[model samples]
Target: MSVDTAAIRRIAKLARIHVEEEALPGLAAEFNGILQWIEQLQQVDTSGVEPMAGGGATALRWRADEVTDGAQAERVLANAPEREGEYFSVPKVVE
Candidate 1:
């Protein structure tokens, strides 16, 4: 399948991409190459293939569900030039 200049212009307008008149031919050629690749992929035979949820069938490993404050308050506040007790102090900008 070949993409014409008009179709390229319409695709560019829909995607909000700026395609100049000189660059439209090159862009259309690239789009035609992509469509040709898709056409070739459509010719592949997959009669007995089983579709999985994702690319692989490996189960995801999960850690224990625990919630905490991350235990790095002092380490995190060490880089603050101005801090108040355990938090960074910022200058009042709004009344």
Candidate 2:
């Protein structure tokens, strides 16, 4: 597929990008090459292939879901600019 200067200009206008007249031909050719590559990709056959989350063969490692105390409240609040008791104090936004 071929893309002309006019089409390139229209695309540039739609994308809100400014393209100079001298650079329109190069942009058009680049767009045409990208479209050609997409067209080529359409010819590949993958009827029986299963879609994969990643390219690797190993399954995702997972840990047991259990609730546990974080045990670092005072240490975490130590860096707070304003704190009350064991919590960071922030300006109230609502009544």
Candidate 3:
């Protein structure tokens, strides 16, 4: 895959990148090299490979789901500057 100066210029225009006229040739060569490397990668065979989430074979650790009361409402409200009944009181914002 050979990337010409015209193609590089078009890519720069589409990407909103400003490339100087002198740098276009260098940019084109670099792009051509990248495309050639990608083409080489496409020739590899991976027909029987299974997709993996991580490099290690370890399983994820998990805990059992259970419900419990957070029984310290009065203790928590004691630190509040303004608390009403069983809740924190704040200035109402809406009319």
TM values, all candidates: 0.66, 0.63, 0.55
The Cα RMSD of model 1 versus the native structure comes to 3.6
lDDT of 3 by residue, 14-90 (tens): 99999999999999889988999999999989678755775457578787776754688889899999989889999
**Number of backbone clashes in candidate 1:** 0
Whole-model lDDT values for every prediction: 0.90, 0.90, 0.88
List residue ranges in candidate 1 displaced over 4 A.
42-67
lDDT of 1: 0.90
- The candidates, ranked best first by lDDT, are 1, 2, 3
C-alpha lDDT of candidate 3 relative to the true structure: 0.88
Tens digit per residue, CA lDDT, model 2, 1-95: 78999999998999999999999999988999999999999999978887677755858899999886578988888899999898889999999
Superposed on all Cα atoms, the candidates' RMSDs to the truth, in angstroms, are 3.6, 5.2, 6.6
- For residue 46, model 1's alpha carbon misses the true position, in angstroms, by 6.1
**List of clashing residue pairs for candidate 1:** none
Better of 2 and 3 by lDDT: 2
